[model samples]
Target: MINNKTIEKFREIETPFYYYDLDVLRSTLDVVKKESENSGYKVHYAVKANSNPRILKIISSYGFGADCVSWNEIAAAIKAGFSPSEIVFAGVGKTDKDIGAALKEDIFCFNCESLQEIEVIDQLASKQKKTARIALRINPYIEAHTHKYITTGIEESKFGINTWELEEVIKRLPSLKNIRLIGMHFHIGSQITRMSVFKSLCARINELQIWFSSRSIDLKIINVGGGFGIDYENPDKSPLFEDYFSLLNEFIDLLPGQTLHMEPGRSIIGQCGSLISRVLFIKNGSNTLFAIIDAGMTDLIRPALYQAHHKIENLTSAGNIYRYDVVGPVCESSDTFAKHIELPETRRGDIIAIRSAGAYGEAMASRYNLRDLPPSVFSDDL
Candidate 1:
């Protein structure tokens, strides 16, 4: 949370920037490290969430691994100081260039999403004369109860290989000469608040593990992909990290030489960041008042894209009560930030904050409408 002192400091700077609370982020990372250390779980920070070089460097210093989805992300993780041995690459449509690069770098594992992808990687690795460690990404079809756009574990999603295809994949694997299938990976969805969904995932994995064991296949790693949601409504409240880790510790059964790997993105940095914007204009409609801001959907698209909610605050004013529909300067009707929001009577030039934007916020930002991209402001520097 930004205190009055921080707000005052922000007023001296420019509007439309991302303000990161490094203290909060460090504390969150400490808790995560403590929990994972206690439970003997290996954590990989998903780089797609917020791949700012500084943030990634800080996270890398904690000895966490990297979960990358593309070639650039793998490079970013490496550039951010994460060792190549600590990086795992996963994606559905990885290009041949990405595969070649990953093989050259000798990354930890490629979370293969399909049989064709497996074949492609094998061919690529064979050409490079390198044996690539791989993990089959299985689509467990578990419902994450999150926004549909972010859900990847459903049957209709294009993310993972379904159960029916497992037998075929195993049969075809012996023919692929350059890839070693060493593990299984499953990622149901993102922003998953329901722990039961994870328990269900664990049960499915246990059944699959037993079935594979019967076939004499011992998995060296079980990559349970990250989806731990954060407290968006109350950004100040710490997330239930202990409970989440304990749930995994209690349920996930591992055989000898098997390790549990978790990819956590939003839960680590979500609450520690906020988007700062300046009120552009106040418009009046028949139904509601609109507090127009300079920051558009291009800056923070979660609301317009996922219909997600973020706690809005007026950093410059207080006490006066009023209602407003917080909106961005984007030209679309869906460019709204908040609908029927209650805030103090706001005027132009006042600074406002959109809270809980650390994860997908900056990563998803674009330069729509020729708007300049927002600069990242760190509390550590202040």
Candidate 2:
């Protein structure tokens, strides 16, 4: 949370910028590391969430592995001080250039999404005279009950390979001598608040494990991709990390000597960040009032992209409360943060804080509308 002192500092910066509470982030990482330390669970920070160089450096300093989905993300992780051996690449599509870059770096593993991807990597690895370790990313058909766009584990999603194709994939593996099938991966969705969805995934994985045992195959690693949700309503509330890790331990039965891995992004960084903006205009509407802000979907897109909500506050106001439809300067009608939200009577030039934006806030910002990108200010720096 930004204190009065921090709010004063915010007034100095330009209107629209990201403010990260490093104290909150470091404490959150400590909780994650302590909770996962019980079972030696390897956690790879998903770089897609927030690849800010400083954030990456801080996370990497804790010796956490990195999970990347693009060649540039892998390069970013390495540049941020994450070791190549601790980096895992996962994505539905990998260009030859992407594969070749990972091959040269000798990345930890590739979470292969299809048989053709495996063959392509094998071909590239053979040309480089190297062996590529891979994990078959399986679509377990589990419904995470999240937004449609964020769901990736369902069979209809074009993410991982369907379960029915497992046999054919195994059959075709003999011809690819340069690739090794190491582990299995599953990612149900993003912003997954339902615990039962993960339990269902564990059941499906157990069934898959039995099928693998029947084939006399021993999996060395089991990477259950992360989608733990954060408390958007309460920015100060910590996520249920201890309970989540405990639930996984109680339900998921691992084979002997099998290592477990996870990719957590939002739950670790979401609440610690906020987008501070200044109210540009206050206009009266037929029913509600409009508090137009300088920040737009171009700065924080979850509201426009996922229909997501973030807590809004009047940082410099303590007057009577009023209802407002907080909106941005973007031309899109869909660029709204909240509707009929209650905030202190706001005026133009008043600082407004959009809470719980650390994860996808600045990371997803764009140059849309030719708007300059928002700069970041850490709590420690303030």
Candidate 3:
């Protein structure tokens, strides 16, 4: 919570910056560690979510593995102290350069989305005189009940291998000498709020694993890709980590010596950061008041892109409640944050804290429209 005293100090610093609460972050990581340890789960922090150097270093200190999508993410993870063997690469598209780089690094496993990708990795690994460990990312066709844009496991999604292709994959696997199948991976979608969605996923995985069992294909890992959602309405509240892990343990029937792996990103860091922006103008419209903020879509695109909600608060104001159309200074009309949201009677120079932005906020910032990217200020620094 940004109190009045904190807001007073914020005046001395620049507005339109990301302010991270290290205390909250540490507490969140503590809970994640406790829960994952209780279940003996191998948790990896998804580097794509929030790769801020400070955040990554702190997470790495906790000894969490990294889940990466791109070559740069793998590089960043390595630079931040993540062991190459503890990293898992996953993406729909992988160029030869990227594959070769991962092979050179000897990353733990590549979550291969296609049989072609398996062949490519096998070819590259053979060239490098190294054996590549890979996990087949299967399309479970489970509806995550999240936003359509984020849904990946459905049949129409281009993220993973379809169910029909499993037979062909198994038949071709014997020919790929340099590539070893170590696990199977599944990711339904992002921002998954329903536990039932995950339960459905467990059932699908159970059904699919039988085919492998019949073939005596031993898997060392079951990498369930993460999409755990955080409470956007209540940023102070933690996600259901205990319930989440327990649910997996109770439902996911694991084979002997198979380890559980999850790639959590948003749930671990979303509540710990806020995008602090100053109110640039208080314009009165015909039937609404507009609180135009200095920060734009370039700084935080989730609101514009996914119509995602982040709790907005005027950290300085102490006045009568009033409704405001909180918006940003971006040229596009989609730069709006919230519509007709109630807040204190806002004025220019009022600092607004956009809550629960720690995950996708700073990591996704861009210099589009020549807007300068906002710097992050951790709570300890403040």
- Per-model C-alpha lDDT, please? 0.92, 0.93, 0.93
TM-score of each: 0.99, 0.99, 0.99
Off by over 4 Å in 2: none
Q: In model 2, how large is the Cα lDDT of residue 353?
A: 96
- What lDDT tens digits, residue by residue, belong to model 3 across residues 151-230? 99998999999989989998999999999999999988889999999999999989878979999899999999999999
lDDT of each residue in 187-210, candidate 2, tens digit only: 889999989998998888889999
RMSD of model 3 against the true structure: 0.8
Model 2 deviation from the true structure expressed as Cα RMSD, one decimal place: 0.7
Q: What is the lDDT of residue 200 in candidate 3?
A: 94
Error of 2 at 332 (Å): 0.6
Task: Give the TM-score comparing model 3 with the true structure, all chains together.
Answer: 0.99
